[model samples]
Structures are given as structure tokens and as C-alpha cells.
Target: MSTAGAHTQHPEHTPGASVRRTREKGEPRFPDGPKADPAGSHFERRIRSFQPRRSRVTAGQEEALQRLWPRWGFDVDGRQRLDLAEFFGNDRPVVLEIGFGMGEATARMAAADPGTNILAVDVHTPGQGHLLGLADQHGLDNVRVGNGDAIILLREMLTPDALGGLRVYFPDPWPKKRHHKRRLIQPAFLDLAAARLAPGATVHCATDWEPYAQQMLEVLTAHPGFENTVADGGFTPRPQFRPLTRFEGQGLDKGHVVNDLIFRRVPHADQPADRAGGDHGADRPEDRDAAGT
Candidate 1:
């Protein structure tokens, strides 16, 4: 089966360096689909987007995308595909989660509240099935899935004030010294996230990787649109709304420390249009132009 519980240098297995062997070619894998090929790269053709396309999104695939996905969709230009009235059940706040592994924590959060909708993204089918299964089990309609590069979805499709919050927990921490470019917590992503958030919206990220945690803090602090919600840095006790997943429980047992960073979008009236810095709408060169908010 495919490695279900690991990523590059993940705490679960010391990343991939210690593994004596990885899945061989043609090896069968779980979720058993095009994206789940153990030997392939989920972000390479990069449907979550953010890269040149070697693949295409077809009709059936779109239908599956519609089904497997939550109500949100970004067009080619990275704009919202639906109106606010259609996408939300109420004017209730929305939270977007990037790379939720296996839907464990997500399901718990959705079950805890009916007034909020959390959009969770990832590229694994079995994980999607697992999340959907859990949601079905709980009759949760508040959770949605975005099965690709969340950056693309955030940067291209979503609009300002489109979200109330964002969450990124334990994403792949591309550790190689040269692979830092591949790390997701970059200026481009932060800007996109800033635009999508309602002023004062929160962007919460957690990581077990020390370097990544540090980088996230610096990048977020430097960005003009946000400020750390907490006065001091370190694990913000898992808020009661977010469930403590099995994986997180394992991390606690291993003496690994998880760092959580929360940043709030400076309000719109207080932050000028220029502060938007070219990320104004879904049109890409940024929705707002040249402004840093």
C-alpha cells in the first residue's frame, strides 16, 4: 500500500531518509487512483495548481471534482466560481484549511459547530473518502474539500473577505537546503491568504518542523496585512473548537513540540486599498494592485 502516514521528513518516520525502501514502481497503493500513485508527485503536474499544467481537468473529472470538492472552485484566473449566496448556507463565517490529513481534526471541528463552514484541501483520495465518510457519519454539511494546491485556490479563485479564517497544520516541510523554494509559507501564499481573509480574519498555522515554524513567523510578521494574534510565540493550546487528532496525540507522546501561529488581517477601513498590494480580486497579478494590505 502507499505510505498513508508520512511525508518528507515527517515526524512519523523521520521524513523519508530512514526508510530503507520506498514503494517500487507498479506497486499497488491505497486510494488507488491517478493521484495516489505512490511513485508519482501529487504537486508536480500540480492540479492543486500553482505550476504549469501537464494534465487537464475534464468533464467527468470536473464532476468528480464537484462531488469530491466543497462548493468552492477557482476559475483559470483564480477567481471564485460561485456567488456568496450560493456557496454559504448562512452569512456564517468561513474557514479554509490547507492539507488536512485524513480528515480527523476537520471532522471533529465541523461536528462541534453548525454555524461555521471549514474548507479543507488535500490531494489524496482515500483521505478524502475518509473525511467524507466521517462527515457522513456525523451528518456534517459544514465541511468542504478542495483536493489540490490550496495556493491556487486561494490565489486565483477566492476574493477578499471571502474567508473568516485559515488553517494549515503539518504540511510537507520540504527540508532540503535547496528545496526551500518549494516550501508553501512564502510571500506569494501569504499575500493570497491575506486577500482572501476578512479584515481581522485569522490565519492559524501549526508545524512540528522547527525551521518552518520560524520561517512562518518571520514571513507573516513582515507581511503588512497581518499581526500575530498572540503576544508570545509557541503552541497555542489546541483551541476547544479544533479537535486533537490521533497524529497530534502521537506527536505529544514523542516529545515533539508543535508551534501554532495565529495572525489577524488588519481591518479593511484601517488598511487602505493600496495595502491590498495587487491582490484585489481573483484576476491574478493580484486582486489589489501594489498595495501591501
Candidate 2:
């Protein structure tokens, strides 16, 4: 018998029949929430820095995504440029947080510093919903959740010097030697990040992977657009502003050493004017690793 005929005959016995019946082609998983693939076909496929994870979203998360997403969240479709001032409804300096897992720390930071706005980007659906819920619960109007690729957000959406600060807490180490190119702290990623960050803005990164931390130090040091905040050009202590996440705490419990790198974006008057537009020639980091904070 043909597969379609069999399914038609035994609709009750067909696997995922209910799901298939409810969801249509090209329809979003959650109609009012972040898109599954926001950047769809607008950009070329390339080596990605992070991998997406398959996980279930909780009831509360689903509710939050449905209710709060329209107000405080947006999909990174790479379709239009965003005005940071207008998006946040204020002229406060906007800090771009590359990957916020579950948004516990992101919420805390937003609560602590209400003066600064945080645009937290992540591909994890549950995390996206959870963050939205947290922001709503805590009345954090300063928090905005961005779905899809951070690279696309930087390259296609945001204007030059659109960010006041950038935070990358515990990005994927990509420990395998063959996968180092997929790490988020590569030279090419730095170039793009530097272009979006305003001069004197701080690019703060933290990680427990020793080798990756060293690589981050080296790359930031070599980049002419950035300067290490520490005079000694070594790892700096984690700042008070950055909350200690449960993931980081667990790594510390296992005797893992966490290194923090705080580099300031410097003015590039002597360099070519086009450098501020970023180097789009290389494969950009797509999303944050699920294992990352």
C-alpha cells in the first residue's frame, strides 16, 4: 500500500498525526513567538560557531512566549535595521549580550542596572521564553530577547557603533582542535563585534576552558581595534556587575578555573573608514553553543 494511503486509512495509528494536523507548512512553531529560523535564505550558509539544541519548552515558557514575546522580543530576520534608541524607547546605552542561557544572570544584571538596556540574544527556545517570563515577572522593561544568529544581528541589523558594551559569558570552548575555527572568539568575530561597539565600550568575556581563555586573550591582544583593560595584559577578575551563574558555579565546584577578559574598543582614526563596517568576508558565528552560558 502507498504510504499516503496507509496514513489515510489508519489516521489514528499514524505517528505524530495530531501534530501534523495542527501545524501547516512554513508556519512558525509558536505563531506569536520567536521564529525557528529567522534568517531564512537571506544569508549564505557557512561554518557556525554554535549548535542548536532540541529541547522541550515548559508550559510557563510557552505562555510567556505567546504573551510577552510580541512586546519584549523580536526575531533576527536580517530584514531591517534596528534603531536601538527607538527599540528600547530610551537613549540609554545598550549592551549586547551574545548568549544568555535560561536568562537567570541576564535578568539579574538587568535588575541591578536598570539604567542600561540589555539586548540578550540566544537560539534556545526555552531560554528565550524563560527570559521573557523572568523579565515580565521582575518588571524588567530594559530586557529584550532576540532570537536567531547573533552574527546576523551584528552584520545585518545593527548600525555602526550601535552598542555601548558587549558581554559574552562562557561562550562555547569548542575544545576539539579541528573545531577551533567554530569558536566564537575568533579574529573574524572580533572584527565584527568591534565594528558594532562604540569606542571606549567594553567587550567582556568569561570562560572556564583554559585553552580557549588563552586563545581569547591572544586574539583580543592582537586585534588593533581593542585594548586590554588590565595594564598587565592578563586575565582580570570577574567584575561585580556580572552575576555568577549556576553553570559557572558548578564548573568552579569541579575545580575548573574561570578566566575573564575585559577589552575596551578603541577609536580607529588612522585605519580605513570601511573597517568600521566590519569584515564580512569570513564565516561568521551563527549562534551560541547550548553548552555555553
Candidate 3:
């Protein structure tokens, strides 16, 4: 389950969201395990926030994936609680980055903070290859790649309060009004994040899509377990650690504005008892139960 492979098709309800699907008779209806089709035929296995796209992978990128991935990449289908010390071979604080497209920013961030282990997740194969290539190029041991549904990884594999920080940068805006439901920063997503983040842990999200930025701000502000880092509850200036992405640079040329939101996980006293008590390095019996380990 920890290895990268094809998604096992499950033409049934996905957790946290009910999706309607049509499949031919006798097609596999249950998620057996990771199957390796890059075509992404197993969409029913999870209601993903991003659509899998087919992109060209150069020979060098493929070479990097084959060589470096065994050391630094993992699949999101893992069900057991991942031991951070074992995963990174270190005790450093770990940051979970969701949807690290093309991985330039992800690699830069990993380079900037050598003490923090970054477990970046994405479904794009080429991007995963590209990021692995960068990690190899820079000799970075702190960066790891994950491919599959991030939601499942957050809910199933990660223990409560096991994260030092989380970053989600420029996720697909899903611009149509009707498609807003597909946005990743929903209330339920925040709830899952609250359960996994340690007290005082931060979630930093950035987007160039204005509407999505506003929605992200509203949802993060509304979540009781988190408090905005800004003094007036507005967007924060881009931190020096975040390099401007190519997409963001193009948007800037077109007069588009980017917004960054940072929210800290509130303490136990500030949140309801049910949502409290997941401080970093603290393990509870419930974690084992949650992972069914």
C-alpha cells in the first residue's frame, strides 16, 4: 500500500463525499489495492480535489523517478500510521505540503529549511518526477514525494498533531460557481486538518485566483480551531521562503493579485474538548484506533 502503483477502481461512494458514477458490468467495484495505470481510471476510489492530467515526461525526468523515487517517494494508499522518524530517518519537524505542482516551490522550500522534513503530495506523475529530479540535483534528504489522494493520507495515515506545519499553494480554483464544492479548503477539510495539526502549528495557503482566495480566507477564519495570523485578518505578505511560481508570475504580469493566508492551530482551552489535545509528539490510544493499526 505504501508503494506507488495504479489506483484500484472503486465504483462506489468515496469517504466524506458521495459521488455518483457509472461503470460497465463486471468492472471492479471495490478498491483492492494500488493498481499502476497512469490513466487514472480509479477515480471512484476517492473524491479528489484535483483532476489527474496527462503531461509529457522527458527521458531525464523518468530516469530520475526510477532512480530517486525508491528513496524519497511514497504513495498515499498507506493505511498504517507512518512513523516520522522512520519515514525521514530523522526527528525533525515535518511539514505536509498538498498539491506541489511542478515542485519548484516545494524544492526551494525544502532547500531553505533543511531542518524541516517536507512530505509533499500530488497526483501529477511528471511533476512528481520533476520534483524528485530537483531533490536529487540539490542533494536534499529532507524532501519526500507522495502520489494519491491527500485527504485519505491525512485521515488514515497521519496521527493527530503529528505535523509541525502544512502548506497548500495555488490549488486548482475550480472557477465555475457550481464547481465551488470541489474546492479543497472546505469546512470538513479544515476539520481533518485541525485533528492532525499540533497546537501552534501553522497552515499556510496561497492562491492567485481571487475568488478562491476569498473563499479560503472565509473558510479558514470560520474554523474555530484556527486563528488568522494577520493582525487585521487580511492576507499576509508573501514570506521570503515562498518563491513566486511561474503561474503567479504570469498572473502578476496580467495584473492579478496573489493572496497568502496563514492560520495557527488554537490551543486546547480555546477549542472544544472534542477538537483539542493533539500537540506535537503527543501520542494517544485513539491514534492507533483511528488508523486501525
lDDT of 2 by residue, 143-223 (tens): 989999999999999998888788999888899999999999989999999888876667889999999999999999999
Most lDDT-accurate candidate: 2
Candidates' C-alpha lDDT: 0.61, 0.81, 0.76
Rank order (by TM-score, best first): 2, 3, 1
Winning candidate number (TM-score): 2
TM-scores, one per candidate: 0.67, 0.84, 0.78
Off by over 4 Å in 2: 1-27, 270-293
Query: What lDDT tens digits, residue by residue, belong to model 3 across residues 1-293?
Result: 24344333344434323323455886642233222442244334645578888665555555566666666877676556788879999887788999998999889878876878899988887788789889988989899888787887888889987887888999999999888888899999999998888886788899999999999999999999898878689888777667898988999999988998888778866557555434442332122222234
lDDT of 1 at 187: 86
lDDT of 1 by residue, 192-214 (tens): 78778877567788888889888
